[model samples]
Target chain A: MIELTDVHKAFGSKRVLRGVNLTIPTGTSMVIIGGSGTGKSVTLKCILGLVTPDRGKITLDGQDVTKGDRDAFLARFGMLFQGAALFDSLSVWQNVAFRLQRGAARRPKAEAREIAIEKLRRVGLTPEVADLFPAELSGGMQKRVGLARAIAADPEIIFFDEPTTGLDPIMAGVINELIREIVTEMGATAMTITHDMTSVRAIADNVAMLHDGQIKWTGPVAEMDDSSDPYLDQFIHGRAEGPIAAVR
Target chain B: MSGATLALAPVAAIGRLAIFAVRGVSHVFRPPYYPREFGQALMQIGWYSLPVVALTALFTGGALALQIYAGGSRFNASSVVPSIVAIGMVRELGPVLGGLMVAARVASSIAAEIGTMKVTEQIDALVTLSTNPMKYLVAPRLLAAVIVVPALVAVGDSIGIWGGYLVGVYHLDFNAVDYLKNTVNYLESWDVVSGLIKGAVFGFIVALAGCYHGMQSGRGAQGVGRATKSAVQAAAVAILATDFLLTALFFTS
Candidate 1:
């Protein structure tokens, strides 16, 4: 389980996150949905320790995420970034096997490559893609590669940041299905942030609506449609005239 | 944009650079060192920079010989060309010019590459993979620059002297034997060693400026372009300034 308690983050004079509190139960997928720049990414970064909150507590399995060994803490979590964030200098397999080939989880080169290939296969990429660089792959392929790298180490927790943001609808659906299937098969606790309604419905076990730097509503994905909150309704239906100003 | 903010900006920039350099240097001695990265940096900073450094030194050396001969003739001391060219190349021109050339080449490349990585979130990805960017990126480049740049300076000095010898023997109507002997006799080992030391310091500055500016890059193509520009500018200025300081220290007596 992951818990964020009263998290607040301000960059210079801009308050990005204002007292955000949420929880994800074990072995479940929780997707955070919000408008652009409403602190969805900041919330994810705060949990990953990439961005420190001004005053908050982030705990993983009841242990404070900020107080422990960073490497050990990071080893338990895998993340697929919004842009895929693949290393341009590395070949596809090398990128996937990056964690396996270094640090405390070091594996022999051949074994790491084998595992990378297996993970690529799991993500529907072939062995032929292993030697190619990230630049050689299409955007959708790159996303798959990123997903392969994320699950390469079989982490206990996984994060997907705007997983289907730039893909075509068909590609986005494919990625959404992959994320849902992978999270189920791995039985990893998943936290995903996306504005895509299709991705939210496909990948989330529960949905948390983040608006004005706070969670306005939280419940099972099934309850999202009938939830009485205007904020949730306005966001889900993509209405422009409600409480959320489209201009900002 | 405020006057007070503008006034304090340079001080803040210097403070940030100092902190970044210290952190980068500190990572060099830590464990989990990446030998592959170190080897790649060696090739990039040292081997790949050879052609440009060699060509620049050669042209400067030939030009110096001609200028020294012209100036020496005014005092009826035209024969001093070879000795002056050798001493000048070994003591100052070789390292300073070579450092500046490398500052333009390698520093810009480093800054742009690292800046792109930072913007792409590759640096953050490295962190997520349990790898420290300083250790995997900055330290290797720093160590490689320190180790390889002295060799480049030495090679530049030798090539520069050869260029002067060619100009003196062929263009200036000087006897080859005498020119070689004068250069060999007048040049001391300390001159060469001092310039090599300058090369090492310049190398450190180049890599430090590159990595520091790159990590501090803001976002997008404009940010990377600015970082590259800052890196080359900072490195060239630092190399020249450090050259002056090192020269004063070495030859003041």
Candidate 2:
């Protein structure tokens, strides 16, 4: 379980996150939906310890995330960045096997490569693609490769940031299905931030709508369509006018 | 801007760079060292840079010989060409020019590569993978630059002196034996040692500036471009400034 309480963050004069309080129960898929630049990424980064909050308490499994062994804390979580964030210098398999190649999780090179190939296979990529670089792959393939890397370590928690942002609808559906299947199979607590309605429908067990740096509405996916909150309705229905302004 | 804020901006920048340098250098002695990354950096910073460094030193040395011969002739002392060329090449020109040339080549490359990584969020990905970017990226490059740059200076110094020998013996109708003898007799061990030390310091500055700017790069192509430009400019100025300070420390009375 991950919990954030009263998280407040500001950059210079811009307040990005103000009093954000949220929780994800164990073994649940919670997808956060929001317009661009509404602090969705910031919230994810804060949980990952990439960005520190000005005032907040974030805990993972009841342990404060800010005050602990960073490596040990990070090893339990896997993240797929918005851009896929693959290392351009490394080959696909090397990127997948990165965690196994060094630090406390170090494994033999041959074994790591074998596991990388297996994970790549799991993500619909062939073993041959393991030797290729990230640049050689198509956009959708790169996203799959990123997915493979995220699940490579079989982490207890996984984060997906804008997972289907740039893909075609068909590819987006495939990725959404893959994400849904993976979360179900691994039983890992998943926190995904995306605005794709299709992705939300396919992958989210619960939906949280963020507007103006706060969660405006949150409910189970079954109840999301009938929530009746004007902000949530405007956002989900893609309306340009409502309590939430179209432009900041 | 307020007067106090303007005054403190440079101090703040210096302080930030100092902290970054300390963090980067501290990672050098820690565990989980990447030998392959260090080896690749060595080849990139040292081996690949040889041709450019050699060519620059050769021309500078030949040009110095001609200029020294011309100036010395006014005093009826043209015989001083080989000795002056040798001392100048070993004590100053070889390292300074070699450092600057490398600052132009390797520093810019490092900044661009790492800055692109930053824009792409690859550094954050490394953090998520339980790897420290300072250890995986900065330390290996820093170690390679500090270690291999002095060797390049040694090679450049030898090539530079040889260039002067060629110009002195052939171009000016000087006796080859006499020129070599003058060069050998006039150059001291401290001259070469001092230049090598300068090479190490310049290498440190180049890598430090590159990593610092690369890490601080904002986002997008413009940010990466600015980081690369700033890195090269910072490295070149740092090389010259450090060269002056080292020279003052080594040769001043």
Candidate 3:
């Protein structure tokens, strides 16, 4: 389980997260939905220790996330970035096998390549795509390669940042389905941040609505439709006029 | 925009650069070195920079010889051309020109590439992947530059003297044998060694400028462009300044 308690963060007096508190249960997929620039990514990065909160307590499995061994802490989590963030200099398999090729979990080159190929297959990429660079692949294909790299080390936790942001509807659906299936099969704690309604419905078991740098509503995805909160309703239905202003 | 603010800005920038350079150089001695990254940096900063450095040295050496011969004729000292060309090339021109050419090429390239990687979150990805960017990225390049630039300077010095030889023997009607003897006998080993030392320092400056500014770059394309521009400018200025200081230390101090 991951717990964030009274997390507050401000960047140069622009308070992005104002006392955000949330809990994600073990072995579940939690989707954080918010409008653009509403601190959804900041919340995720805070948990990952990519961005430090001004005041907060974040714990992973009863241990503080910020205090332990960094490499050991990071070794347990895998992340797929919004832009895929694949290393352009490396081939697809090399990118996927990056973690396996270094540090305490280092493996032989052949073994790492074999595992990378297997993960690529799991993500619907052919073995022939392994040698190609990220620049050679389409956006969707690059996202799949990113997905393959994320799960390459078989981490205990996985983060998907705007996983389906730039894909077409069909391709987005495919990625959402893959994320949902992979999270289920791996039984990893998953935290995904996205405003995509389709992705939320497809990949989330629970949903947290972030508004004004705070969680306005939190419940199971099944309860999201009838949550009875005006903010949640306005956001889910994509209404322009509501208590929540469209323009910041 | 105030006078005080303007005055303090450069001081703050210098402080930041000093901190960055010290931190980067400190990483060079730490454990968990990446040999592969070192090898790649060696190839990129040294091998790829050869052509530009060589061409610059050759032309400067030829020009110096021609100018020296012209000036020496009025003083009835035309025979001083070979000795002056050799000494000037070895003690100053070879390393300074080679360092500047490399600063223009390698520093800009490093900054742009690393700045793009930072903008795209690749550096963050490296962190999440259990790799330190300083160790995996900057240290190897720094070490490679320090090790390889002297070798490049040595090669540049020899080629520069050879350029002078070509101009002297062919264009100036001087005997090839006497020109070679004058260049060889009049040039002390300290002159060559000092320039190579200067090369190593210049290399350190070039890599430092690239890695530091690149990591400190802001977001987007304009940010990357500024970082690249700052890297080359910083490197060239630093190389010239350090050259003067090193020259004083080597010859006067």
Pick by TM-score: 2 or 3, better one: 2
Error of 1 at B75 (Å): 0.4
- Model number with the top DockQ: 2
- The local lDDT score (0 to 100) that residue B118 gets in candidate 2 is 94
Q: Pick the candidate with the highest TM-score.
A: 2
Write the residue-wise lDDT of candidate 3 on A1-248 in tens digits.
99999999999879999989999999999999989888999999899888999998999999999997999999999999999999998999999999999998899999999999999999999999999999999999999999999999999999999999889999999999999999999999999999899999999999999988899999999999999998889999999988789888
Fnat values, candidates in order:
0.73, 0.97, 0.70
Kindly report which residue stretches of model 2 are placed more than 4 angstroms away from their true locations once superposed: none
Residue-wise C-alpha lDDT for candidate 1, range B1-253, written one tens digit per residue: 8999999999998998888899899999998899999999999999999999999999999999999999999999999998899999988999999899889999999999999999989998898888999999999999999999888988998899999989999999999999999999998889888989999999999999899889988899999999999999999999989989999999998
- How many residue pairs collide in each prediction? 0, 0, 0
Predicted structure 3, TM vs. truth: 0.97
Off by over 4 Å in 3: B1-7
Could you tell me which 10 consecutive residues in candidate 2 chain B have the lowest summed lDDT? B82-91
